[model samples]
Target: MKLAGLTIAYWCVLVMALVPMGCAWLAKAGQLGKPRRQGGFDNHNPRAWLARQTDWRARANAAQDNTFEALPFFIGAVVIAHQLGAVQMRVDVLAFLFVVLRLLYVMMYVADLATARSAVWALALLVNIAILFV
Candidate 1:
């Protein structure tokens, strides 16, 4: 179903776009309240701050980068699918699946489950490709 004439696939694109921000928040979780000198998130030089992250924080940051890398293809696929007159319901379902898999991938990434994360990433990529052809 569409909200304001935007299909679920389009909504999924918006959600996917925001996923990187959520990953960034996760990367900086728990350190935002302290002073910058005490290892808090640095609004100034944020890239340096994020680059200094380690462990799961680093993983979350990496996930953020990967999510950003994935976004353009997903966006293009949805747009092309719509322009190609692909079935809306199939596209929406695939897009939703892609989102779910990507979210799962992020969780697995943060949890340090490399094998599962890679698997989920592959699945989400396949889902995005399916959206292009649906």
Candidate 2:
């Protein structure tokens, strides 16, 4: 019953999913705010719409892509740690760190800081790897 609603690693997975949604929302909002949007929020072809962007909105789209790409590894690490009886407290802490670093990664991406964003991404990946080994 303790794992029903408050597992930290599970919450980390939920947050991981939500991160990309937030990026997409930022891109959509950014697109809608453009003074001369050639195409207004192309729900039917959003990737094409985003490809036409070249600023923060584009960065947001790219960040969303990176977030999605990172999910499988993070999810697998969490699941393996949980299944193999890794220390819950350690797993929870690493999961939380990964979430924090990933959020920072998104912020750095949207801010157009490529080097810092990569650093955050590396840190988040390290956290996931650590969760697996430690």
RMSD of each candidate relative to the true structure: 0.8, 2.3
Candidate 2 lDDT, 1-134, residue by residue in tens: 13676688888899998999999999889456544446667776777878897788889989999999999999999899989988989999899899999999999999999898888888898899999987
What tens-digit string does per-residue lDDT give for candidate 1 at 82-132? Answer: 999999999999999999999999999999999999999999999999999
User: TM-score, each model?
Assistant: 0.97, 0.90
Model 1 segments more than 4 A misplaced: none
Error of 1 at 61 (Å): 0.6
Q: Give lDDT for model 2.
A: 0.87
For model 2, where is the 10-residue window of minimal lDDT? Answer: 30-39
Please report, in order, the local distance difference test score of every candidate based on alpha carbons. Answer: 0.95, 0.87
